[model samples]
Target: MNADRTKYLNRRALMGAAAASLGLAAVPALAQDNSTEMDAPSTGPVHNNTSSFRMLDWRPYFSDTRNGAILVDTTSRALHFWSEDQSIYKLYPTSVPLTEDLTRRGRTEVVQKVVGPTWRPTPAMKERNPEWPDFVPAGPENPLGTHALYLSWTYYRIHGTHDTRKIGRRSSNGCVGLYNEHIAVLFGLTKVGTQVLLV
Candidate 1:
């Protein structure tokens, strides 16, 4: 293997170990294959923007203790933001990685929240697809969309995606992908250190 590839693998392994040690609540593992190849980000301009998913009553899915928690239901491809009383929740459709393991479940905190985040393909990603750019400046064309919520102590993120078509499907490299508009609203509601539970 190339030196760059070797380095990337090593770093990925270390990150995996760290996540496993973070004491995230373990959910029942899935055994079925869920691999779905992702197409390259669209270069064309986006138009007629609309979301296929709806904002619905989410009280049944939230807990009183987890008020303001970001609960991501990967199986349903949905994200729920709980209200102060856990009496209401706002729902948004999201895209997750095809491999269930790629979606880090359990618990993590929002370490950083950025508006218009730049896109940087990981070394491992670049190795697999040499056409991937090393860095993409923050903009409409960027895959990270308009806002990003970086999870603490891991490489995962709940971020916006330029490709709205991918929402409500298994189509990301590993991060949770949302529509640009949906993420913008979510970004405003979220704060640093907010708890996120992926299930």
Candidate 2:
């Protein structure tokens, strides 16, 4: 099969598994991320931005989830934000890179919530791109976008991206990338100790 077809098939399998594990009534059809390296990155800071991108209404899938919990569906490249009662939730498109051992499946907690987060590329990132700085001050140029939720798992985060188009694509170095506007909403709803489940 061709690459595109292979990707679709793989995502379908993964999504199926996640829905089953979570007891989701159904998994909505998701859009494929077509972002490429050739696309130009955004410049300068983006503040108070609102999203026009598609997001899932997570209420149906969140009934069994913990209040104020976060559940990431890697296959769908979506993040579910549960409300205080799991009766309501907002979902956002995200970027989950298809790299080796990049999936951080299992239960974890939010270790930190940062606004305008400064990014320090990991050794792996530096090794991949030596030109990257040891630190990227939070700005439009920074990949961390507007807000960030640091997970207990080292080097994992659910954060925003400077490039709005990158959302819904598998384009991160393991971190989950949300739209700046979407991240702002998630940041407000989440706390330091909120549960996070990645599937």
Candidate 3:
């Protein structure tokens, strides 16, 4: 009877180890798929629990892929970019605005691209947070992370964030946020005239 018990325990231990290894392997896959981990910019409660990381065609959104096209789906919490010739298609999980009041949808273009972009609180942001510093130079401490693509709209940008927790969630003040590394890749792919649509 003691030998039988030892055999059962050994089997259980092996099974448990297998399950643990499988679970560990899934962690990276979840991040890669842009699953429920997507967060948008804001301070409000997270009403949206999951992101819809679907690949969409540019035809439905843009009339033409002039100078490349970018589509930001606030509902899905995803950003899709198509290269000018449609040779490269990239999808990235993004952090959107915390609230609809802070969200802006519609057409815009990348007016500037900055590496190590500086950050300054908008008038509205300053009014809301009186204690926030007037300016933050380009660095790790800056909210704009390592790269930024300034849009046509004032005080709005699509940029990188050092805060990994912000990715795959709704955590931005107004601008869309991406992981620092992901934004670096996007920064290289996109140019100043790239067309952008937020919906």
Each prediction's RMSD over C-alphas, in Å, is 19.4, 13.1, 7.6
Candidate 3 overall Cα lDDT vs. reference? 0.79
Tens-place lDDT digits, model 1, residues 1-199: 9999999999999887875675322311320111111223633332222333334344454444343678787777878775555554467778877565555688787889999888777665666678777778888778888889998745678898877787777777778888788788778877786778787
Q: Which model is ahead, 1 or 2, in terms of lDDT?
A: 2
Q: How would you encode candidate 3's per-residue C-alpha lDDT over 162-189 as one tens digit per residue?
A: 8777777777887888888889988998
**Which numbered prediction scores highest in TM-score against the true structure?**
3
TM per model?
A: 0.67, 0.68, 0.78
> What C-alpha lDDT values do all the predictions have?
0.68, 0.69, 0.79
How much does candidate 1 score in TM-score?
0.67
Q: C-alpha displacement of 118 in model 1, angstroms? A: 0.5
Error of 1 at 153 (Å): 4.1
True-vs-predicted CA distance for residue 22, candidate 2, Å: 25
The list of candidate 3 runs beyond 4 A from truth reads 1-49
Give a tens-digit lDDT track for model 2, residues 20-122: 7865525344322211111123222222322233345555444455547787887777777767675555767777765546566878888888998888877
Question: What TM-score does model 3 achieve against the real structure?
Answer: 0.78
- Between the candidate structures 1 and 2, which one is better when assessed by TM-score? 2
**Which ranking of candidates, highest lDDT first?**
3, 2, 1
